[model samples]
Target: MVTFQFIPFQEIENLGSAKRVNKLLNIVKENKIVLMEGRLKKQEEADLIEITMEEISPKFKGIELSVVYPNKSKQDFGQKVKGTFANLLLGDRQGMTIIGPASVVKRIEQNPNKIELFTKEAKTPPAKRYRKKK
Candidate 1:
Protein backbone atom coordinates (compact mmCIF):
# COMPACT_ATOMS: atom_id res chain seq x y z
CA MET A 1 0.00 0.00 0.00
CA VAL A 2 1.11 3.53 -0.78
CA THR A 3 1.16 5.99 2.09
CA PHE A 4 1.63 9.75 2.13
CA GLN A 5 1.33 12.75 4.41
CA PHE A 6 -0.84 15.68 3.46
CA ILE A 7 -0.41 19.36 4.31
CA PRO A 8 -2.96 21.94 3.34
CA PHE A 9 -1.51 25.22 2.12
CA GLN A 10 -3.88 27.13 4.37
CA GLU A 11 -2.14 25.55 7.35
CA ILE A 12 1.09 27.32 6.49
CA GLU A 13 -0.36 30.28 4.63
CA ASN A 14 0.16 32.72 7.47
CA LEU A 15 3.61 31.57 8.46
CA GLY A 16 6.83 33.25 7.33
CA SER A 17 8.83 31.63 4.55
CA ALA A 18 11.48 30.35 6.98
CA LYS A 19 8.87 28.76 9.18
CA ARG A 20 7.19 27.12 6.22
CA VAL A 21 10.49 25.69 5.07
CA ASN A 22 11.26 24.30 8.50
CA LYS A 23 7.86 22.72 8.89
CA LEU A 24 8.09 21.08 5.50
CA LEU A 25 11.57 19.77 6.22
CA ASN A 26 10.58 18.25 9.51
CA ILE A 27 7.63 16.39 8.01
CA VAL A 28 9.59 15.24 4.98
CA LYS A 29 12.33 13.73 7.17
CA GLU A 30 9.83 11.10 8.27
CA ASN A 31 10.28 9.54 4.78
CA LYS A 32 6.70 9.65 3.51
CA ILE A 33 5.57 11.49 0.42
CA VAL A 34 3.82 14.78 1.17
CA LEU A 35 0.95 16.10 -0.91
CA MET A 36 0.44 19.80 -0.38
CA GLU A 37 -2.40 21.77 -1.79
CA GLY A 38 -1.21 24.96 -3.52
CA ARG A 39 2.36 25.64 -4.36
CA LEU A 40 5.01 26.91 -2.04
CA LYS A 41 5.90 30.58 -2.02
CA LYS A 42 8.94 31.52 -4.10
CA GLN A 43 10.99 32.49 -1.09
CA GLU A 44 10.02 29.30 0.72
CA GLU A 45 11.02 27.14 -2.24
CA ALA A 46 14.42 28.78 -2.45
CA ASP A 47 15.01 28.52 1.26
CA LEU A 48 14.02 24.85 1.28
CA ILE A 49 16.58 24.00 -1.40
CA GLU A 50 19.32 25.89 0.36
CA ILE A 51 18.68 24.25 3.69
CA THR A 52 18.41 20.76 2.19
CA MET A 53 21.73 21.13 0.44
CA GLU A 54 23.42 22.22 3.62
CA GLU A 55 22.16 19.19 5.51
CA ILE A 56 22.63 16.50 2.84
CA SER A 57 24.76 13.49 3.72
CA PRO A 58 25.70 10.13 2.20
CA LYS A 59 22.96 8.23 3.99
CA PHE A 60 20.27 10.88 4.17
CA LYS A 61 18.96 11.34 0.65
CA GLY A 62 17.48 14.64 -0.46
CA ILE A 63 13.90 15.37 -1.37
CA GLU A 64 12.17 15.49 -4.75
CA LEU A 65 9.99 18.57 -4.95
CA SER A 66 7.58 19.21 -7.82
CA VAL A 67 4.48 21.22 -8.69
CA VAL A 68 1.46 20.18 -10.74
CA TYR A 69 0.40 23.38 -12.46
CA PRO A 70 -3.16 24.14 -13.40
CA ASN A 71 -4.18 23.62 -16.99
CA LYS A 72 -6.41 25.95 -18.99
CA SER A 73 -8.08 24.79 -22.16
CA LYS A 74 -10.07 26.69 -24.76
CA GLN A 75 -12.90 24.88 -26.46
CA ASP A 76 -16.27 26.60 -26.39
CA PHE A 77 -16.64 30.37 -26.59
CA GLY A 78 -19.07 30.59 -23.67
CA GLN A 79 -16.85 28.38 -21.51
CA LYS A 80 -13.84 30.46 -22.52
CA VAL A 81 -15.56 33.65 -21.35
CA LYS A 82 -16.44 32.09 -18.02
CA GLY A 83 -12.93 30.74 -17.57
CA THR A 84 -11.39 34.11 -18.28
CA PHE A 85 -13.45 35.73 -15.55
CA ALA A 86 -12.63 32.93 -13.12
CA ASN A 87 -8.94 33.30 -13.89
CA LEU A 88 -9.12 37.00 -13.27
CA LEU A 89 -10.61 36.41 -9.84
CA LEU A 90 -8.73 33.32 -8.74
CA GLY A 91 -5.43 34.05 -10.53
CA ASP A 92 -4.87 30.38 -11.29
CA ARG A 93 -6.33 27.15 -10.07
CA GLN A 94 -4.18 25.92 -7.21
CA GLY A 95 -2.14 22.80 -7.90
CA MET A 96 -0.53 20.19 -5.69
CA THR A 97 3.07 20.19 -4.55
CA ILE A 98 4.76 16.92 -3.64
CA ILE A 99 7.85 16.51 -1.52
CA GLY A 100 9.57 13.33 -0.41
CA PRO A 101 12.84 11.44 -0.29
CA ALA A 102 14.32 10.72 -3.73
CA SER A 103 14.90 7.13 -2.72
CA VAL A 104 11.19 6.47 -2.25
CA VAL A 105 9.52 9.14 -4.37
CA LYS A 106 11.26 8.03 -7.61
CA ARG A 107 9.75 10.44 -10.16
CA ILE A 108 6.87 12.84 -10.59
CA GLU A 109 5.36 13.81 -13.91
CA GLN A 110 2.94 16.64 -14.51
CA ASN A 111 0.47 16.49 -17.36
CA PRO A 112 -2.23 18.90 -18.41
CA ASN A 113 -4.91 17.19 -16.35
CA LYS A 114 -3.07 15.07 -13.78
CA ILE A 115 0.01 14.43 -11.69
CA GLU A 116 1.71 11.03 -11.97
CA LEU A 117 3.81 9.63 -9.18
CA PHE A 118 6.33 6.84 -9.73
CA THR A 119 7.81 5.25 -6.65
CA LYS A 120 10.51 2.69 -6.02
CA GLU A 121 9.29 -0.80 -5.26
CA ALA A 122 9.69 -1.82 -1.64
CA LYS A 123 9.97 -5.50 -2.53
CA THR A 124 9.86 -7.43 -5.82
CA PRO A 125 8.58 -10.94 -6.12
CA PRO A 126 10.34 -13.39 -8.38
CA ALA A 127 8.83 -14.11 -11.76
CA LYS A 128 6.99 -17.41 -12.31
CA ARG A 129 6.89 -19.42 -15.51
CA TYR A 130 3.84 -21.36 -16.67
CA ARG A 131 4.12 -24.18 -19.13
CA LYS A 132 1.33 -25.71 -21.27
CA LYS A 133 1.74 -29.41 -22.18
CA LYS A 134 0.78 -30.44 -25.69
Candidate 2:
Protein backbone atom coordinates (compact mmCIF):
# COMPACT_ATOMS: atom_id res chain seq x y z
CA MET A 1 0.00 0.00 0.00
CA VAL A 2 2.89 2.35 0.65
CA THR A 3 5.42 3.27 -2.04
CA PHE A 4 9.04 4.17 -1.44
CA GLN A 5 12.51 4.01 -2.98
CA PHE A 6 15.93 2.81 -1.85
CA ILE A 7 19.17 4.51 -2.85
CA PRO A 8 22.84 3.69 -2.43
CA PHE A 9 25.75 5.74 -1.17
CA GLN A 10 27.46 5.91 -4.53
CA GLU A 11 24.45 7.57 -6.13
CA ILE A 12 24.27 10.09 -3.31
CA GLU A 13 27.93 11.01 -3.56
CA ASN A 14 27.56 11.67 -7.27
CA LEU A 15 24.86 14.28 -6.64
CA GLY A 16 27.38 16.91 -5.55
CA SER A 17 27.17 16.82 -1.77
CA ALA A 18 28.37 20.46 -1.46
CA LYS A 19 28.73 19.51 2.15
CA ARG A 20 28.21 15.94 3.31
CA VAL A 21 24.99 17.22 4.78
CA ASN A 22 23.71 18.23 1.34
CA LYS A 23 24.08 14.71 0.07
CA LEU A 24 22.34 13.29 3.11
CA LEU A 25 19.48 15.75 2.75
CA ASN A 26 18.85 14.99 -0.92
CA ILE A 27 18.28 11.32 -0.18
CA VAL A 28 15.68 11.83 2.54
CA LYS A 29 12.45 10.44 1.18
CA GLU A 30 9.43 9.05 2.96
CA ASN A 31 9.53 5.31 3.59
CA LYS A 32 12.70 5.12 1.55
CA ILE A 33 15.93 3.33 2.35
CA VAL A 34 19.54 4.41 2.08
CA LEU A 35 22.32 1.92 1.82
CA MET A 36 25.64 3.36 2.92
CA GLU A 37 29.13 2.72 4.28
CA GLY A 38 31.17 5.22 6.23
CA ARG A 39 34.74 5.03 7.45
CA LEU A 40 36.84 7.83 8.75
CA LYS A 41 39.58 8.77 6.33
CA LYS A 42 42.80 10.31 7.50
CA GLN A 43 45.90 11.44 5.67
CA GLU A 44 47.83 8.38 6.76
CA GLU A 45 45.58 5.70 8.14
CA ALA A 46 41.81 5.45 8.27
CA ASP A 47 39.62 4.10 10.98
CA LEU A 48 36.13 2.84 10.31
CA ILE A 49 33.46 4.59 12.25
CA GLU A 50 29.98 3.24 12.27
CA ILE A 51 27.71 6.17 11.78
CA THR A 52 23.93 6.11 11.96
CA MET A 53 21.61 8.17 9.82
CA GLU A 54 20.77 10.46 12.71
CA GLU A 55 24.41 11.51 12.87
CA ILE A 56 24.42 12.49 9.21
CA SER A 57 21.87 15.23 9.60
CA PRO A 58 24.38 18.00 10.22
CA LYS A 59 21.29 20.00 11.09
CA PHE A 60 19.81 17.15 13.17
CA LYS A 61 16.31 17.69 11.79
CA GLY A 62 14.30 14.86 10.24
CA ILE A 63 15.51 16.05 6.84
CA GLU A 64 12.70 14.07 5.23
CA LEU A 65 13.91 10.73 6.63
CA SER A 66 12.12 10.10 9.89
CA VAL A 67 14.00 8.52 12.78
CA VAL A 68 12.31 5.90 14.92
CA TYR A 69 13.77 4.73 18.21
CA PRO A 70 12.67 1.93 20.44
CA ASN A 71 9.95 2.68 23.06
CA LYS A 72 10.12 6.37 22.38
CA SER A 73 8.25 8.65 20.01
CA LYS A 74 7.96 11.54 22.45
CA GLN A 75 10.69 13.50 20.66
CA ASP A 76 11.23 14.09 16.95
CA PHE A 77 12.30 11.08 14.90
CA GLY A 78 15.72 12.59 14.21
CA GLN A 79 16.17 13.55 17.80
CA LYS A 80 15.22 10.45 19.73
CA VAL A 81 15.17 7.18 17.84
CA LYS A 82 18.00 7.76 15.36
CA GLY A 83 17.06 6.54 11.87
CA THR A 84 14.91 3.46 11.91
CA PHE A 85 17.05 0.45 11.14
CA ALA A 86 15.83 -2.98 10.12
CA ASN A 87 16.64 -5.77 12.55
CA LEU A 88 17.35 -8.27 9.80
CA LEU A 89 20.25 -7.04 7.77
CA LEU A 90 19.80 -7.10 4.01
CA GLY A 91 22.38 -7.51 1.26
CA ASP A 92 25.83 -6.55 2.58
CA ARG A 93 24.62 -5.65 6.04
CA GLN A 94 28.05 -4.81 7.42
CA GLY A 95 27.16 -1.79 5.40
CA MET A 96 23.88 -0.03 6.28
CA THR A 97 20.47 0.65 4.83
CA ILE A 98 17.89 3.22 5.86
CA ILE A 99 14.20 2.48 5.69
CA GLY A 100 10.82 2.94 7.25
CA PRO A 101 9.25 0.56 9.73
CA ALA A 102 8.87 -2.98 8.48
CA SER A 103 5.22 -2.70 7.45
CA VAL A 104 5.83 -0.06 4.78
CA VAL A 105 8.95 -1.87 3.66
CA LYS A 106 7.19 -5.20 3.50
CA ARG A 107 5.04 -3.69 0.78
CA ILE A 108 8.05 -2.61 -1.24
CA GLU A 109 9.58 -6.06 -1.57
CA GLN A 110 8.49 -8.37 -4.37
CA ASN A 111 5.30 -10.45 -4.14
CA PRO A 112 4.41 -8.96 -0.80
CA ASN A 113 1.56 -10.78 0.85
CA LYS A 114 -0.24 -10.07 4.08
CA ILE A 115 1.73 -12.97 5.45
CA GLU A 116 4.93 -10.96 5.52
CA LEU A 117 3.90 -7.67 7.10
CA PHE A 118 1.24 -9.17 9.28
CA THR A 119 3.60 -11.73 10.64
CA LYS A 120 6.03 -9.07 11.80
CA GLU A 121 3.31 -6.80 13.12
CA ALA A 122 1.66 -9.60 15.05
CA LYS A 123 4.93 -10.21 16.83
CA THR A 124 6.51 -6.79 17.27
CA PRO A 125 4.46 -3.84 18.58
CA PRO A 126 3.09 -5.78 21.52
CA ALA A 127 6.51 -7.24 22.21
CA LYS A 128 8.20 -3.88 22.26
CA ARG A 129 8.00 -3.91 26.04
CA TYR A 130 8.22 -7.60 26.98
CA ARG A 131 9.03 -10.75 25.07
CA LYS A 132 5.91 -12.71 24.25
CA LYS A 133 5.72 -16.08 25.93
CA LYS A 134 6.58 -18.92 23.63
Candidate 3:
Protein backbone atom coordinates (compact mmCIF):
# COMPACT_ATOMS: atom_id res chain seq x y z
CA MET A 1 0.00 0.00 0.00
CA VAL A 2 1.05 3.55 -0.62
CA THR A 3 1.56 5.83 2.34
CA PHE A 4 1.58 9.60 2.56
CA GLN A 5 3.14 11.71 5.28
CA PHE A 6 2.19 15.33 5.84
CA ILE A 7 4.84 17.60 7.28
CA PRO A 8 3.85 20.99 8.58
CA PHE A 9 5.99 24.03 7.74
CA GLN A 10 6.70 24.63 11.40
CA GLU A 11 8.30 21.19 11.67
CA ILE A 12 11.12 22.10 9.33
CA GLU A 13 11.15 25.86 9.68
CA ASN A 14 13.90 25.72 12.28
CA LEU A 15 15.96 23.00 10.64
CA GLY A 16 19.11 23.79 8.70
CA SER A 17 19.09 23.35 4.94
CA ALA A 18 20.90 20.04 5.06
CA LYS A 19 18.75 18.71 7.81
CA ARG A 20 15.57 19.68 6.00
CA VAL A 21 16.66 18.00 2.82
CA ASN A 22 17.79 14.91 4.68
CA LYS A 23 14.52 14.66 6.50
CA LEU A 24 12.58 14.72 3.26
CA LEU A 25 14.94 12.28 1.62
CA ASN A 26 14.68 9.83 4.49
CA ILE A 27 10.93 9.72 4.13
CA VAL A 28 11.08 9.25 0.39
CA LYS A 29 13.57 6.45 0.83
CA GLU A 30 11.04 4.60 2.94
CA ASN A 31 8.62 4.56 -0.02
CA LYS A 32 6.40 7.16 1.53
CA ILE A 33 5.15 10.26 -0.24
CA VAL A 34 5.71 13.50 1.65
CA LEU A 35 3.22 16.31 1.41
CA MET A 36 5.08 19.30 2.71
CA GLU A 37 3.29 22.43 3.77
CA GLY A 38 5.58 24.90 2.01
CA ARG A 39 8.10 24.92 -0.79
CA LEU A 40 11.84 24.89 -0.30
CA LYS A 41 14.25 27.62 -1.36
CA LYS A 42 15.83 27.21 -4.78
CA GLN A 43 19.21 26.51 -3.26
CA GLU A 44 17.72 23.94 -0.93
CA GLU A 45 15.92 22.26 -3.81
CA ALA A 46 19.18 22.00 -5.74
CA ASP A 47 20.94 20.57 -2.73
CA LEU A 48 18.20 17.99 -2.27
CA ILE A 49 18.54 16.80 -5.86
CA GLU A 50 22.32 16.66 -5.62
CA ILE A 51 22.19 14.65 -2.44
CA THR A 52 19.55 12.36 -3.83
CA MET A 53 21.77 11.61 -6.81
CA GLU A 54 24.64 10.71 -4.53
CA GLU A 55 22.47 8.36 -2.49
CA ILE A 56 20.85 6.58 -5.42
CA SER A 57 21.12 2.78 -5.42
CA PRO A 58 19.27 -0.34 -6.59
CA LYS A 59 16.72 -0.12 -3.80
CA PHE A 60 16.69 3.61 -3.35
CA LYS A 61 16.26 4.76 -6.93
CA GLY A 62 15.75 8.49 -6.17
CA ILE A 63 12.97 10.96 -5.59
CA GLU A 64 10.23 12.71 -7.56
CA LEU A 65 9.74 16.25 -6.36
CA SER A 66 7.36 19.02 -7.33
CA VAL A 67 6.22 22.33 -5.94
CA VAL A 68 2.89 24.02 -6.53
CA TYR A 69 2.87 27.73 -5.98
CA PRO A 70 0.66 30.59 -6.97
CA ASN A 71 1.39 32.52 -10.15
CA LYS A 72 2.13 36.11 -9.28
CA SER A 73 2.35 37.40 -12.85
CA LYS A 74 -1.29 38.40 -13.03
CA GLN A 75 -1.44 39.96 -9.59
CA ASP A 76 -1.86 43.76 -9.23
CA PHE A 77 0.86 45.91 -7.75
CA GLY A 78 -0.87 46.19 -4.39
CA GLN A 79 -1.42 42.47 -4.15
CA LYS A 80 2.16 41.75 -5.14
CA VAL A 81 3.43 44.12 -2.51
CA LYS A 82 1.25 42.49 0.11
CA GLY A 83 2.45 39.06 -0.91
CA THR A 84 6.05 40.15 -0.68
CA PHE A 85 5.49 41.50 2.78
CA ALA A 86 3.75 38.32 3.84
CA ASN A 87 6.58 36.18 2.55
CA LEU A 88 9.13 38.37 4.25
CA LEU A 89 7.38 38.12 7.57
CA LEU A 90 6.02 34.59 7.50
CA GLY A 91 8.77 32.93 5.56
CA ASP A 92 8.15 31.23 2.19
CA ARG A 93 5.10 29.31 3.29
CA GLN A 94 3.10 29.95 0.16
CA GLY A 95 2.98 26.62 -1.61
CA MET A 96 2.90 22.84 -1.29
CA THR A 97 5.86 20.54 -1.90
CA ILE A 98 5.56 16.90 -2.85
CA ILE A 99 8.40 14.43 -2.52
CA GLY A 100 8.07 10.72 -3.23
CA PRO A 101 10.29 7.75 -3.94
CA ALA A 102 11.03 7.44 -7.66
CA SER A 103 10.43 3.70 -7.53
CA VAL A 104 6.87 4.29 -6.41
CA VAL A 105 6.16 7.64 -7.96
CA LYS A 106 6.53 7.30 -11.70
CA ARG A 107 6.05 11.01 -12.44
CA ILE A 108 4.34 14.11 -11.25
CA GLU A 109 2.38 16.30 -13.65
CA GLN A 110 1.16 19.76 -12.83
CA ASN A 111 -1.15 22.20 -14.54
CA PRO A 112 -2.33 25.62 -13.44
CA ASN A 113 -5.44 24.18 -11.85
CA LYS A 114 -4.43 20.70 -10.75
CA ILE A 115 -1.71 18.12 -10.20
CA GLU A 116 -1.46 14.47 -11.24
CA LEU A 117 0.75 11.94 -9.51
CA PHE A 118 1.40 8.71 -11.37
CA THR A 119 2.62 5.73 -9.38
CA LYS A 120 4.15 2.39 -10.32
CA GLU A 121 2.33 -0.83 -9.69
CA ALA A 122 3.41 -2.85 -6.69
CA LYS A 123 4.78 -6.28 -7.54
CA THR A 124 4.17 -9.25 -5.31
CA PRO A 125 6.58 -12.14 -5.10
CA PRO A 126 5.33 -15.56 -5.94
CA ALA A 127 4.52 -17.89 -3.04
CA LYS A 128 6.74 -20.86 -2.46
CA ARG A 129 5.41 -24.43 -2.69
CA TYR A 130 6.51 -27.46 -0.69
CA ARG A 131 6.34 -31.16 -1.63
CA LYS A 132 6.18 -34.09 0.77
CA LYS A 133 9.26 -36.41 0.81
CA LYS A 134 8.87 -40.24 0.83
Candidate 4:
Protein backbone atom coordinates (compact mmCIF):
# COMPACT_ATOMS: atom_id res chain seq x y z
CA MET A 1 0.00 0.00 0.00
CA VAL A 2 1.11 3.53 -0.76
CA THR A 3 1.25 6.16 1.96
CA PHE A 4 1.56 9.95 2.02
CA GLN A 5 3.59 12.10 4.40
CA PHE A 6 1.88 15.19 5.74
CA ILE A 7 3.82 18.19 7.04
CA PRO A 8 2.09 20.92 8.89
CA PHE A 9 2.84 24.54 8.08
CA GLN A 10 3.63 25.43 11.66
CA GLU A 11 6.33 22.78 11.75
CA ILE A 12 8.40 24.47 9.06
CA GLU A 13 7.36 28.07 9.55
CA ASN A 14 10.19 28.88 11.96
CA LEU A 15 12.85 27.03 10.02
CA GLY A 16 15.27 28.90 7.78
CA SER A 17 15.14 28.55 4.00
CA ALA A 18 18.05 26.15 3.80
CA LYS A 19 16.76 23.99 6.61
CA ARG A 20 13.28 23.92 5.11
CA VAL A 21 14.59 22.81 1.72
CA ASN A 22 16.74 20.16 3.30
CA LYS A 23 13.80 18.80 5.25
CA LEU A 24 11.64 18.69 2.13
CA LEU A 25 14.37 17.09 0.04
CA ASN A 26 14.85 14.34 2.56
CA ILE A 27 11.15 13.46 2.49
CA VAL A 28 10.84 13.35 -1.30
CA LYS A 29 13.97 11.24 -1.55
CA GLU A 30 12.07 8.50 0.25
CA ASN A 31 9.53 8.25 -2.62
CA LYS A 32 6.71 9.67 -0.55
CA ILE A 33 4.34 12.44 -1.53
CA VAL A 34 4.30 15.42 0.86
CA LEU A 35 1.06 17.25 1.54
CA MET A 36 2.09 20.53 3.12
CA GLU A 37 -0.58 22.42 5.02
CA GLY A 38 0.53 25.92 3.99
CA ARG A 39 2.23 27.50 1.03
CA LEU A 40 5.92 28.19 0.88
CA LYS A 41 7.28 31.69 0.61
CA LYS A 42 8.29 32.77 -2.90
CA GLN A 43 12.00 32.90 -2.08
CA GLU A 44 11.87 29.60 -0.23
CA GLU A 45 10.10 27.89 -3.10
CA ALA A 46 12.58 29.24 -5.66
CA ASP A 47 15.57 28.17 -3.61
CA LEU A 48 14.06 24.73 -3.19
CA ILE A 49 13.60 24.35 -6.94
CA GLU A 50 17.13 25.51 -7.69
CA ILE A 51 18.74 23.23 -5.12
CA THR A 52 16.56 20.29 -6.09
CA MET A 53 17.37 20.69 -9.79
CA GLU A 54 21.08 20.63 -9.07
CA GLU A 55 20.69 17.40 -7.11
CA ILE A 56 18.91 15.60 -9.92
CA SER A 57 21.10 12.95 -11.55
CA PRO A 58 20.71 9.69 -13.45
CA LYS A 59 19.62 7.85 -10.34
CA PHE A 60 17.69 10.65 -8.65
CA LYS A 61 14.42 12.19 -9.81
CA GLY A 62 13.60 15.83 -9.18
CA ILE A 63 10.46 17.06 -7.48
CA GLU A 64 7.18 18.42 -8.81
CA LEU A 65 5.48 21.19 -6.81
CA SER A 66 1.90 22.41 -7.02
CA VAL A 67 -0.23 24.76 -4.97
CA VAL A 68 -3.82 24.24 -3.88
CA TYR A 69 -5.65 27.55 -3.63
CA PRO A 70 -8.28 28.13 -1.03
CA ASN A 71 -11.93 28.64 -1.95
CA LYS A 72 -13.50 31.91 -0.84
CA SER A 73 -17.02 30.99 -1.72
CA LYS A 74 -19.51 28.90 0.29
CA GLN A 75 -18.01 29.91 3.63
CA ASP A 76 -20.31 31.07 6.42
CA PHE A 77 -20.19 34.60 7.83
CA GLY A 78 -17.97 33.68 10.80
CA GLN A 79 -15.52 31.76 8.66
CA LYS A 80 -15.42 34.43 5.98
CA VAL A 81 -14.77 37.14 8.52
CA LYS A 82 -12.07 35.12 10.22
CA GLY A 83 -10.38 34.37 6.93
CA THR A 84 -10.41 38.01 6.00
CA PHE A 85 -8.79 39.00 9.29
CA ALA A 86 -6.20 36.30 8.94
CA ASN A 87 -5.37 37.41 5.43
CA LEU A 88 -5.03 40.96 6.58
CA LEU A 89 -2.62 39.96 9.33
CA LEU A 90 -0.72 37.44 7.23
CA GLY A 91 -0.63 39.67 4.10
CA ASP A 92 -1.95 36.85 1.89
CA ARG A 93 -3.82 33.60 1.99
CA GLN A 94 -2.02 30.33 2.49
CA GLY A 95 -2.70 27.19 0.43
CA MET A 96 -1.63 23.58 0.42
CA THR A 97 1.58 22.70 -1.42
CA ILE A 98 2.25 19.28 -2.85
CA ILE A 99 5.79 18.02 -3.30
CA GLY A 100 6.73 14.65 -4.71
CA PRO A 101 8.95 12.80 -7.14
CA ALA A 102 8.62 14.03 -10.70
CA SER A 103 8.12 10.55 -12.06
CA VAL A 104 5.26 9.80 -9.68
CA VAL A 105 3.76 13.28 -9.66
CA LYS A 106 3.66 13.54 -13.42
CA ARG A 107 0.51 11.42 -13.35
CA ILE A 108 -1.24 13.59 -10.76
CA GLU A 109 -3.95 16.02 -11.84
CA GLN A 110 -3.29 19.48 -10.34
CA ASN A 111 -6.76 20.86 -10.12
CA PRO A 112 -7.51 23.29 -7.30
CA ASN A 113 -10.80 21.63 -6.46
CA LYS A 114 -9.51 18.09 -6.60
CA ILE A 115 -5.88 17.01 -6.56
CA GLU A 116 -5.33 13.38 -7.48
CA LEU A 117 -2.29 11.13 -7.60
CA PHE A 118 -2.69 8.00 -9.67
CA THR A 119 -0.64 5.11 -8.40
CA LYS A 120 -0.14 1.86 -10.26
CA GLU A 121 -2.36 -1.05 -9.34
CA ALA A 122 -0.81 -3.71 -7.13
CA LYS A 123 0.24 -6.92 -8.89
CA THR A 124 -0.67 -10.42 -7.83
CA PRO A 125 1.27 -13.58 -8.43
CA PRO A 126 -0.18 -16.01 -10.92
CA ALA A 127 -1.63 -19.26 -9.68
CA LYS A 128 0.35 -22.47 -10.17
CA ARG A 129 -0.98 -25.13 -12.53
CA TYR A 130 -0.38 -28.86 -12.34
CA ARG A 131 -1.01 -31.37 -15.07
CA LYS A 132 -2.72 -34.67 -14.27
CA LYS A 133 -0.82 -37.88 -14.87
CA LYS A 134 -1.08 -38.99 -18.51
Full candidate order by lDDT, most accurate first: 3, 4, 1, 2
Q: For candidate 3, lDDT tens digit of each residue in 41-129?
A: 99999999999999998889999999998778878999999989988887768899999999999999998878999999889888888
Give the Å shift of residue 25 in candidate 1. Answer: 1.6
Local distance difference test, per candidate? 0.77, 0.33, 0.93, 0.78
Candidate 3 clash pair list: none
Candidate 3 weakest lDDT stretch, 10 residues: 86-95
Candidate 2 deviation (Cα RMSD):
18.9
Residue-level lDDT of model 2, residues 41-123, one tens digit each, is 23101111122343444343332222212333454866443424432332122233333333233332322121222212333
As a whole number from 0 to 100, the lDDT of residue 62 in candidate 1 is: 87
Off by over 4 Å in 4: 71-82, 89-93, 120-134
TM-score of each: 0.72, 0.25, 0.87, 0.72
lDDT tens digits, residues 69-127, model 1?
54555357787777678657654236678998777888888766677788888876788
Residue-pair clashes per candidate: 0, 1, 0, 0
TM-score winner among the candidates?
Answer: 3
* lDDT score, candidate 4, position 108: 70
lDDT of 4 by residue, 23-120 (tens): 98889888788888877788888998999989898766788787776677867889899888887876323778888877556667875468777655
